[model samples]
Target: MRLEQALRSGRHLSTADPTEAELLIVNTCGFIDASKDESISVIRDLDSSRRKGQQLYVVGCLTEIAEAEVRATIPNVDATFGAEQWDAVAASVGPASANFDIPQPEFTNIKQPSAYLKISDGCDRPCTFCIIPTIKGAMHSDTVSRLIAEAKAHARDGTRELVLVAQDSTAYGEDQGDREGLATLLEQLSEAVPDLPWIRLMYAYPGRVTRLLAETMARLPNVVPYLDMPLQHASPSVLRRMKRPTVNKSRESINHIRKAIPDVVLRSTFIVGFPGETDSEFEELLTFIEEQRFDHIGAFTYSAQKGTPAATLLEQVPEAVKIERYGRLMELAQSISHDQNREMIGQEMKVLVESAEPTTSADGSPVVIGRTYRDAPEVDGLAFVKGEFKPGSMVDVRVEGALPYDLLCSPLDFHKP
Candidate 1:
């Protein structure tokens, strides 16, 4: 999105098709093997299909970590830029054509009901299995004033839900010497965008969900009580190897947050197969998930990224074992997720309508897809409500049924909670 804004600001023509553009920019991700493979495949496919004069430039996380690898492996790449180099990319494409036969079209901002407002970039924590800090460097947060301005802009642009995202959202203001920076920022944003219906937070690190932050969330009407904290693993031995906080500390943080926000919807992520992960350790993770009973859970198989310390760790779990463990973890998560959805069957919740589907229910009611406050965009489940709703409007709904990962809901009379 920042890249698109940069090009638009430079008066460059934006084409949805790469074939129509003179310069083909491919933003790549090199976070894990799967992401890296997808990025390389995309670059390869585009390079092979692009016109003779079209320049292919690679940028983003992949380039930051492996510019030489990308350049060497794909000899056709014209240039490469690391992450956060949007201006450089725009400049490289040169200024937009002036006084052309066809004048450049005005910038068209897509209307989205929910907007992810990135409060900070990069990471500072030293986790052995991760490569984020290596790729994006240390953490740095945006100023509260700047973030409030951004939040207000999002509100004016018809964004019903503003999601705060960062490498570590709970660590928002440590770089600026502010201990309760995130709590303070939330207060300011809530005051700044009073009309914004929902403010969601994602990617909070464990052991950092301070009491003050939880209280601020509980106090604010707009800020939803949803926390996405990724506890890679639960085993104390595995956590020690990963350089993460102790399990007891993470449990304390979770308890504190839940106590403050009693109705909080908890979302978490876990890594299934880590180096030297024994059956007992994996069972411990499953036990932790069962005990937590998180509303939403995302699990991933461990990937050994180059230059990460975990890649060189002894007793790396076999590929077959990783796959097996990943399946088991997700199976448990699915059952837990189903149970969580079931609890909402009789609850009245507000849903931000995303789109209307062509399909209808058994009774022939039109289906509108949406997300509840419990679900974040993309990475979480959706609500399929029986009604015709404006795409960007928020509506109250009573959940009538539950699916493994979604809810079946019907429109309810507006009660203005």
Candidate 2:
């Protein structure tokens, strides 16, 4: 997004088609083997279809982590820049105009109902199974004043919902010597953008869900009661190996969050089939998932990344075992999710309508697909309401039916403007 804003400031026109653009930028991901493969595949496809005098540049996590391999494998790339090197990229691409030097916060969600406001960057946690810290470095939070300005910008640009994202949202201000930084920031953002209807938080680290944070969330009317805490695994032994907090600490944190926000929709991610993950440990994770009964569960099979500690760990679980465990974890999560959705039947929820289209259900009616407070924009489920509602309108919906990950809703009132 920063790069796009920079290019635009430099008077470079944007195009959706690669063949039309003079310079093609591929923002690549290198979080895991799968993402790396996907990135390489995309670059290869673009290179094969490149026209004369067109330049291809690779940037972002993949370029930052594995520049040599990228250069070696695909020598056609004109240049490479690491993450946050937007200025260097702009300089290399073309001469900057007078207005290019001016600092402007890039609003990716301009004209959209929802926008993601990145509060911070990087991670400080030393989870052995993770590669984010290695790629992005230690946590650095944006100033509260600056974030409030950005929040106001987003609010000014028709953003009804603002989603706060970071590599480690809970660790927002440790570098600035503020322990309650995120809580304080949220309070100020609520004040700064009072008209903005919804504020959602994502990527909260475990054991960092402070009392102040929970209380602030419960107190704020606009802040949604939804949390996305990625607890990779539950077994004490596995957590110890991954260098994460113990299961007991996680349990305590969960208890505290639920106690503070009783109606909060809890969403979590887990990693299955870690190296040397015994059957008992895997079973322990299943038991924890069943006991927690999370509203949303995102589970991934452990992918051993090169240069990570877990990659070289002994007793690496076979590919077949990882796939098997992933299926089982998702199966259990589905059943629990279905039960949770069933409990929400007949409840009213405010939905931020995303799209309205004709439905193919037995009843030949048009439907509006939107997300409730419980569901995030892309990584979560949707509420399908049978109606001819306008997109981006906030509508009151009553849950008439339930699916495993979505809600079958009916429009009650279009009260919100």
Candidate 3:
């Protein structure tokens, strides 16, 4: 989004084809080893294929973590900037067009119904497996007033759903020592932008989720009952090695949240094959998953990121073991997901229409693709609706059929409330 803002400020037109553009901005992610490899591949590919006079700038987390490596290895990159250096990037690209004024707080180029509002940046946590703190620094939150203004702007610009994001969402305002910061912000945003249909929260730290926060979510009609708390592992021993809160604490937190919001859709990610994770520990994680019955689960094999404490831990799990564990975990998660989806059959849900393209179903009838409140924008499943609707419109959908991850629905009616 910063890149988009920079381009708009410079009055540069976006091109779908990289070959057609004079300058290509490669914003990269360095969250994991896999992401880093992918970013490198993209940079190399773009550099190799660029026409004469084309400029390539690499920016973001990858640059922050490995600027020296990027500059040394990718000689075609004209410059590299960290995630927070948008001003330098703008300066390198020249000034804003005389006629164009940069929009404040909101991106005018964004036309999606769902938007991510990053209320805070960076992290202060010492999770042994994470390198985010090293790359992005400590937690810094935007003021409540500023975030509220941004939320209102998003609503005015056709965004119906807002997903509040941060490295540790529940830890918002702790840097400034306000314990009830996130709760206060949510209340203000709800009142300020009543038009936004769904306000979802992600990347919440379990320890930081105060009772007031949960209560605020339950009270706010727009704040959808969904929580994305990434509990990296379930075994107490593994969690200890990861420098995370105990598994008992996690269980207690989940139980409290479930009791507070009975219909809450829980989403989480887990890391399999953490160092020294025995078969018994893995079984413990599996049992926890079975007991929790989360609406969505993402399982990943632990990547031994460089410069992290876990990288040098004893008894590193083998690659084959990691792969096997990942498969087993995902297979179990799929069964749970299937059961959860099947339970929603014959239920009515409010679906945010994503795409209304002309496509015939198996019976040669047209259908639309949308998502329910339970599904986050890109990471989760979609709802296929048999109806004529405009993109970004919300409508009522009756689940006629269910797959393990998606829903086949018939449009009931257009939803106003």
Q: Which residue pairs overlap in candidate 2's backbone? A: none
Tens digits of lDDT, candidate 3, 1-417: 656676666776567799898888898888887788899999999999999999999999999988888888897799899887887888899864557554544555567789999999999888998889998998999888878877877898899899999999988888899988899889988999988999999988866677788888989989999999889889989999999988877777687678789889999999999999999999999999998898999877988878899999989999999999999999998998889999999999888988847467988978889899999988889999886788898888888888999998887753333
lDDT of each: 0.87, 0.86, 0.86
Give candidate 1 regions above 4 Å deviation.
13-22, 44-55, 68-76, 98-108, 356-365, 413-417
Error of 3 at 74 (Å): 4.3
Question: For residues 225-328, what per-residue lDDT tens digits would candidate 2 score against the true structure?
Answer: 99989899999999999999888878877887898998789999998889999999999999998889888889878888777899899888988999999999
> Which residue pairs show collisions in model 3?
none
- 1-417: candidate 1 lDDT, tens digit per residue: 678777876666668778799888999998877788899999999989999999899999999988998988899999999999999998988767755443322323556798888999999999998899988889999888777877777777788998999989988999998978899998999999999989998998888888888888999999998999889899999999999989997898798889999878999888878999999999999999999888888877899988999999889999999999999989888999999899889999888999844367788867889999999999999998876888887888999999999999888863345
- Flag regions of model 3 displaced more than 4 Å: 13-20, 48-51, 68-74, 96-109, 413-417
TM-score to true structure, per model:
0.91, 0.91, 0.93
Model 2 residue 53 CA deviation in Å? 4.5
Cα deviation at 300, candidate 3, in Å, is 1.4
Best by lDDT: 1
In candidate 1 the C-alpha lDDT for residue 165 amounts to: 96
